[model samples]
Target: MILAAGQPDAPLLELFLAATAGNVLGAVVNFVLGRFLLRFEHNRWFPVSPANRQRAEALFNRYGRLVLLFSWLPVIGDPLTLAAGLLRTPLPVFLLYVTIGKAARYAVLLWAYTTLAG
Candidate 1:
């Protein structure tokens, strides 16, 4: 919505900051949920399937903390954060990486809007 709007009502800096903050907060919630819900694996209502969980775990293992850099992606993003929590990733580390990813994503979107819309 923000990207497609072309010209947002709010200032670009405000938009960027708000989007980054909201996305990071959401990821944090997902992480906490993952931490507490570790024992609820395989339930029908689980957001991530067993296959997705395995894949996320594999990626996290292979890339270490760096994989959180892609946590802004759509389908796999939530699982990545959840996996980080399930794996007991440090809060400071998760916040740092996820904030960078989401801020970069919004910055790119804003740049594209300016470049292409002008």
Candidate 2:
């Protein structure tokens, strides 16, 4: 999008490749960061307080497994994964949800790039 926006008739292949590469890497980083760096029980980064965790836990206990469909949303998505991990939301299910969410998010990003940037 940057190139296309800058210079008309920019190479589509290169832009697509670059966008895909970054999105894939970003998803990996999101998963890894959730698994390793962040803390759900005690969020050091933001306002994912224990009270909030409890509320999120209650939600997770109920509809969490499904929210994975929206796992790519800003703010809540990344921390949701971390909370899922800390709460021991079965690893298999968590991975499944996260992947689904990430895929959807990437799809939207790709479409946006193709439409506006391509």
lDDT of 1 by residue, 1-118 (tens): 4442545464778778988999999999999988887767778987778887787678788889988999999998998898889878999999999999999999999899878876
**What is the C-alpha local distance difference test score of candidate 2?**
0.62
Off by over 4 Å in 2: 1-55
Cα error of candidate 2 at position 109, Å = 1.8
TM-score of candidate 1 relative to the true fold: 0.77
Tens digit per residue, CA lDDT, model 2, 1-118: 3575247676655765565456445555555655563344355765457786678679888874787656567887666666665555666676666666666665676678668865
Cα deviation of 115 in candidate 2 (Å)? 3.3
Worst 10 residues of 2 by lDDT: 34-43
Q: What's the lDDT of the predicted structure labeled candidate 1?
A: 0.86
Q: How many residue pairs clash in all the candidates, one count each? A: 0, 0
Q: Candidate 2 at residue 59, lDDT? A: 84
What TM-score does candidate 2 reach? 0.53
In the predicted model 2, the residue pairs found to clash are none
User: What residue runs in model 1 are displaced by over 4 Å at the alpha carbon?
Assistant: 1-5, 39-59
